[model samples]
Target: MKSEDIQIRDPFVLPIPEEGKYYLFGSTDRNIWGPGTGFDAYVSADLAEWAGPFPVFRPPADFFADTNFWAPEVYARGGRYYMFATFRRKDNDLLGTAVLAADQPLGPFLPHSGGPVTPESWSSLDGSLFEDEAGEPWMAFCHEWQQIGDGEVCAVRLGADLREATGEPVTLFRASEAPWATPYVSPRYPDTANYVTDGPYLFRGDSGALYMLWASFIDNTYALGVARSASGGIAGPWHHQPEALYRNDGGHGMVFRAFDGRLLLTIHAPNRTPDERPLFLEIEERDGRIALAGRTSE
Candidate 1:
């Protein structure tokens, strides 16, 4: 199948340089709000052509979460692959991120954590793994604006095994802190408006600068913004760029280096339910910040 034909959201690409393959995962269930199904991944040798709806993760019958299995990001660490994804239980309204394990990138991933690692009281999602220079693992996730009037991007230290939170979450920044982020008015609560913070992916530039790619609303449309950490760490005194990195109604993005050493940004475009498809754009670092080069021909 072609990438443009795949229906997905929160698009994350895991490029396996050794295998020369890319694995794509995201919020893929047909009815995202209903009982959750498992996650499916597509493999590609080139960014254009893809294969498989390979079932990388399927919850066991006794799994705690039955809906909102979202934003599964696979990372290779300590000789094993770990997945950081979000889930919500029917017994409770709170949604949080969890850690899963698999022997391979394209997995039969199984739950490795005790349960959702984010605070049970907080509504959080889109957890991405970040390992510090000291080799400590951390999770950077969004504290959803649905619960808080201004959504926040926060970080918590993860245990060595990648299964539990080792420290209290530190608020890195709020959606309102970003000059480019705009308020999104809730349809259900017309009088209430909130700033949104979605998908937080961390990147360490070749220049040794720390950067974060997070999604929010600009002009009431889904957009991706860039933030820089002056301290070169997760606990950042982050500064937001004046404008969005990508603002074409596509977001929930993650960046990966292609096999040929090209920096690529993967995101789901159109920002609409059921019609969203993965879109790839070639990106380059310019003046210590990310700039869109052009869409990848492949």
Candidate 2:
């Protein structure tokens, strides 16, 4: 499949060294006409030609299907690949993040836990995992502004089994708290400043500086930014830089090393609501910070 042939938001690619191929996963929809369905995974060897839309996951028989299925990211850990994704519940009108497990990257994934890592009562989404220096697991997720008014990013310790939350989730920062984040003002909510919090992925810099790449709107345009953890840990006093990492109305980014050992960031640019394409850019670490090195044709 060509890049435009694949319709997805928050595209994540996991390169399997043993197979010499990449597994791609994201939201696959029929049209921009209704709520999102489940996700699909595709395999590619050269990042140009794709092989399978191999059914990685779909709503189970009689499963909750009306609400959105958004931002599915796969991570390989401890001999198993795990998928962290966002799902909303129609029965209670609540949103949360859940974990799925599989033996392979392009998987017939199975729900490992009963539900989300965040509490059922909280309206949360975009949950991602991070491992600290001591090899401790942590989940950082967003508390939706639709329910809280000001969206927030929260973190909590994950149990060893990766099935349950070890403790309560702590508020890390609000969407409005970042110096670079702007409020979305539309006629829908005219009186107040509406905030949004989207994807959050953790990366430990080569210099041991911990950072987070998250998405939000700046002047109602989609953008991605990076924040540094002062303590070099997940539970830290994070400080947001004054500028965004990518500001092309695109976001929901993840950092990975290319097959050739160069650092790369993958995100969808020109972030139209329903139709978006995966874009990869070369990135470099300079002075313990990340920046756009260039764009790659690959």
Candidate 3:
């Protein structure tokens, strides 16, 4: 199937240099708010065409989470692969991120963290793995706006094995900190308007600057924004970009380099249920910031 034909959200692309292929993963279950089946990934030599909706993860019969499986990000480390994703249980409204592991990029990934690594009480999602200069692993995730009036992007220290959180989570920044992020008011709670923060992915620029790609609403439309770490680390005093990197009613983006060495940004477009499709845009880093070049050619 072509990438345009595949319906996915919170798009994540993992480039396997060894196999000369890219594996795409995201929120694939049709009923995202209800019970989730699992995660499916697509493989492609180029970004345009894909093959197989390979099942990378399937919850065991005794799984704790019965709904809301979202944002599966695959990271290769030390000859093994780890998947950071979000899941929630019907018994409790709280949502959190968990770690899953497998031997291959596309896999029957099994739970590695025992359960969600994020705090049991705090609502969170979109856990992304990053290793610092000292080679210590960290999980960057969103503290959802649903619980707090303002959503936040935070990081927690991960154990060497990447199965557990070793330290308390530190707030990197809030969604309202970005000039472009707008508040989303729930109709059910007319008096309470919340600023949303979602999908936090860290990228180190060629110039050695650390940037975070995160999602929120801008002018009532889903948008993607960039934040720079002033301290040049994940545990940063972050500076938000005045404008959004994308504001076309699409978001939850991540960056990856293609096999050809071109920098590409992938996001699910239209921001509507079932109709959403992964869109890849060519991007360039200039002045230690990110700028969209345009959509990749067919």
Candidate 3 C-alpha lDDT tens digits along 65-168:
97889999999999999999999955577898999999988888999997889998899899999999999999999998888889999999999998789999
Model 1, clash count? 0
Structural similarity to truth (TM-score) of each candidate: 0.97, 0.93, 0.97
Query: Candidate 2: lDDT of 79?
Result: 94
Model 1 over residues 12-95: C-alpha lDDT tens digits? 888888888888888899767677899999999998999989999999988879888899999988888899999996558789
lDDT of each: 0.89, 0.81, 0.89
Worst 10 residues of 2 by lDDT: 289-298
- Model 1 TM-score is 0.97
Please report the TM-score between candidate 2 and the true structure.
Answer: 0.93
How many backbone clashes does every candidate have? Answer: 0, 0, 0
Q: For candidate 3, which ten residues in a row score worst on lDDT?
A: 289-298
What is candidate 2's lDDT per residue for 6-51, written digit by digit as tens? 7778888888888888888876664423575577888887677888
What's the lDDT of the predicted structure labeled candidate 3?
0.89
